[model samples]
Target chain A: MSYIMLSYTDLLLASLLLMINGVLSVIFSLGLLKRLVIAVTRMVVQLLLVGSILSWLFAAPSPFWTLLAAFVMVAFAGYEIVSRQDRPLKGFWSAGLGAGSMTVASMVIVLLALTTQIRPDPWYHPQYMIPILGMILGNTMTGVSLGLNTLTNAVRREAGAIEAGLILGMSRHKAMQGVIRQSLRNGLMPLINAMSVMGLVSLPGMMTGQILAGAAPQEAVKYQILIMFLISGATGFGVIISVLGASLRLSDNRHRLRLDRLASGNGK
Target chain B: MLEIVNLHRPGLSPVSLRIDDGECLALMGPSGSGKSLILRAVADLDPNEGRVRANGDERSQTPAPLWRQKVGFLPAQPGWWGESVGDHIEKSDSVLDLLHKLHLPDESLNWPVSRLSTGETQRLALIRLLAHAPKVLLLDEPTSALDEEARKSVEALLKAQLSNGVSILLTTHDKKQANRLCQRIFHINKGVVTEAFS
Candidate 1:
């Protein structure tokens, strides 16, 4: 059987359908037109900038340049995660370190383990490494931010109980166990739900993209399964590290909750 | 025992007060007299320019969590830290007994907090705090929301707890309640604490 490839006109019609759908969504939604416009504009600008950069990176892929670009992406994502919470720059370094380490480790491991036959020049392949690392780091960043917020807020809200526990001969760490557990659950819920509904409720973006790029349906499905599993693992590890690391900054040497500093917007 | 030294608000003279262990000290003052501020400062719930020590340990030296646990605070309007009433009580076994003593039924554990009357919620909050068994009890108009009978019952229950070796420091605008509940009274005026009666 021969497959009929879509012509330029068909592509144009497809693009127009997306635009019309967006417009219709904006019209039917209440108080969302401005937000929709802003989001669309932001997407256009960001994609255009990234498109240019990726084009250049792919044209001349060097190890040094590729690593530098990845570092830059991680740094920006780290800053964004911190800035989004209106938190201080204190956690910026930690977040950057966490994101950088996790993304690079996962990307390298997956690439080496799966795509070892790709080529001799493997570490800096823009097509495979960049997109995969971007997805992993982006999800990890979100997990960190969510975990951090949930942990901090939980500690604050339950400060009284925590104190009660401490007075009852519980150690500081023991007192914080509840908050930590709750934060972990809250952080991991999205990833868990996504995993639960992987194929039934929605087609994941990576698999959909791979299929659209003409990969076999079976191959795309396998990759999707691998990526989702990896993402969940990365997210879990990232959230735990971020929470534990962030908690260190929130207490004093005596293991007391340093509310004065964490509060009053100083941590931000 | 609790002590406050140089506790002063802006544009006011320093105020000082000391309460012995197991003593019920009533703080009485008009509005804006800074009575509540003293209770908050002692509880370490407010930032202030003063020194507070619980059982001879300075605020900074003592662990705040330990201090807070030992010091039960009932604010004028209690704030629930959880979504449900049962969530606050599920951690311990004595919460049921306290709830019963406070005249709240077992079914109240499942009732949405929004549905509770101010008086009932206040009682529930008191019971919640009491379950922790703090060494010092700080009451900031704790009975302000209750009816006359409820107020009397609460006062009697608190009076009975004096033998439990807990220090009680309270603030109230009601002179009659103050006379009935406290062995000593301190009147705050413009941030200055003065011994009004003993």
Candidate 2:
């Protein structure tokens, strides 16, 4: 089966759908017209940029370009996580630690998947490496952001109860056990729900793309399952690293909570 | 068996005091006199420029959780976590006697904390503190939410703890209750600490 490529005219015709939605947004007084326009515009620009970069990357297939792109993706992801945090860590710590953990965990997972399972002709093959890294980093970034936001808010709201635990001869780890558990649950819940209702409720983007590219249903399903598993593991690892790091950073050695380092009360 | 050295805060003056084993010291002050802040500082729950020694061990030298364990703090409006009361308390036979002493039935342990009244929560919080067998207990109006009878019962329960050599520092607006329980009374107004003339 051959994959059908879209022409520039085909893309232009499809873009009109966004204009129709933007018009409706204004007519309905939803006040989402500005956001809709910006989102659509940004999506087009970002995808075009990524498309150009990938074309160049796949042509050369250099380890340097692949690593550099991966780094940028993770850096952007880290920035997103920090910005989304209600009580973001001070100065560079928020972005630094957040990006560092997500990059390390997502890269390791993607690398292992590539080397052992996919086994691309070259281990650092840009075709497989860049997209895989982007997917893992993107999903993991969302998880880390959700977990950190929930954790910081929970710690603040339940300050009295947490202090009570500490006063009751509990170690810091023990005192924060409930909050940590809740944060992890919050992080993973969306993915878990999606996994549970995947095929019946909605065809996921990857599977839909694969089908559109003329892949057999069975083959597309297999690839989608693998992608789902990879995403789940990456999300868990990202949340664990971020929440643990944030928790430690926000507490003193004496197990005292110091939320003063937070820049804002509400996560953006 | 607890000593506070030069405990200073913005509103509260540099205050120093000591309570021997089996003794209760009361801090009496008007609202907003920084009494609760003083108790919080002694418990190391709040950051303050002060030194607290529990049985000659400095608070700074000890880890916060361990120090707090030794010097337990019960706030005025106690915080309760866990769905059921039993979830917070350790499962022990001694807890039954404690619940009994505090006028709470054994079945109350299994009851949800959400169902507990303000007075019940207050007693249960006091019982929870005593359950830890802390050497020094810092209480903030432990009886404020209780009725006259419940207040007496809580005072009696505290007396039992005192007999076991637990040192206590408490805050109260009720002079009679302070006189009844505390051997020494300190007055605070606008954060200045002074000993009452008895």
Candidate 3:
């Protein structure tokens, strides 16, 4: 193996890879060409901004600024996730709980387990915490959105059964048991599928990134396993807490459903 | 008795109707004649510009869910959401008796709702409604899906349940069933309810 110095050529090569991916995406005509273009453009702009800010922060590292940036990322991601769904964005508490809990839990685990001994600064290291927290928050956003969508649809479709349960002296929680179960199952299925097929079928992003950065294959694999476990656990917690919190918001003090609040897209 | 005042659709005159307790009031009308709307209004399922008083109590005084539980409203088609038949039917003494009256077998409790036929599901839906012991049963084409024999059995079941101080407001296009089942008949034409048969 030979070590090569980083050069402008490397940036050109990365741009070429992006172009090839774009061409292949167009050739496939996957009906997501518009979305792909928008995603790539946004990713480029966001990374450029992040890189510039991070370069400065790393040079003159401020712990408070780094932590604030991570919080902003979580909050922005939470808003985007909730707004993307069919439901209205009246319930911010659930979104906050989901994003804050998962981001904090996973970031703490990554910091304490892997980098605490290795890195000089632990609490708010821009190089370590920003990237790790970003990954965790992104995953949590997906989990929360999926959970909320499934739950809202389930409740809407099963209104009659829920009403029947209410008539039978059952509380709202008891009435919504089936809907809650089905929604949680639907929300968790994607993460479960991903975890089941991991390692053998796919090289996860973290492992691939490490290998490209000249880390040993074994070291990268260990990090990938740890991160995957952390992500899956965080996602589970996020989905469960978000669903429960959102369900509570749907009901009133008397346990009657205030369905008007959760109504989708301009109630008729 | 159930009294409906100012029960009017948009761009139509208000209607008033009063039926005594234990009376079977059959509402007959063509499609889109506001027959089902009347039933929904009584059940408090629809927001309408009117007042409905059931058993001497104004609807506004009673909670909507409590009102709905007392006023059992059956739409043309049953709305099913549970997985198994037993899942939908809560434990009650009258549940098995109502199931038997509707000609459903004891084994129906174990069957999945997906396995139920349209007629069986309709019967089961009626049984489920009656199991709650609603004071007023509002049916919109309750037996429209059934054959002659099933309709007869359901009619008989409704008649049997009338002794328990239950008031039924049934809607149907079948004149013979209406004549056989109702003590009073209200015809809805051009968005107005008129007493046509008694």
Q: Pick the candidate with the highest TM-score.
A: 2
**Clashing pairs for predicted structure model 3, backbone only:** none
Score residue B138 of candidate 3 by CA lDDT.
Answer: 90
Colliding pairs, model 2? A86-A267
lDDT of 3 by residue, A1-268 (tens): 2234667678767867776667777888756667767987899789889989889878776878887887788778866755656764355554565555556555665566446433546556687777766776677678777877788777777777675565443566877788788767876787788888888898789888888788898988987777677677767777787777777776653455556666454232
Per-residue lDDT of candidate 1, residues A1-268 (tens digit): 2235767688657656556656777778755657767886788689879989899989987778777877787778777666555343243444553455456545554465346533335656776678877877777777777777787777777777665444333456776787888877877888888889889999989888778878888988988876776677678877787777666666544555555545334344
- Better model by DockQ: candidate 1 vs candidate 2: 2
Give one digit per residue, the lDDT tens place, for model 3 in B1-198. Answer: 688888765633577878778888899989888888787667755445688888888877876667777778787767665788887787566787777777777878778988889888889888878877788889989899899888888998888767666888999999888888888888987677755767
Task: Select the stronger candidate by TM-score from 2 and 3.
Answer: 2
Q: What is the lDDT ranking, best to worst?
A: 2, 3, 1
lDDT per residue, candidate 1, B1-198, as tens digits?
877788755534577767778678898988878877777666665545677776777877777666777777777766554567876666456877766677778888887877889998889878877877877888989899999888987887788677776778999999888888787998888777755776
Off by over 4 Å in 1: A1-13, A18-49, A79-125, A145-183, A211-219, A242-268, B6-15, B31-33, B46-51, B56-61, B80-115, B131-133, B163-165, B189-198
- lDDT scores of the candidates, listed in order: 0.72, 0.85, 0.74
Tell me the docking grade of candidate 3: incorrect
**Which stretches of model 2 miss by more than 4 angstroms?**
A214-219, A266-268, B8-14, B48-50, B60-63, B91-94, B189-198
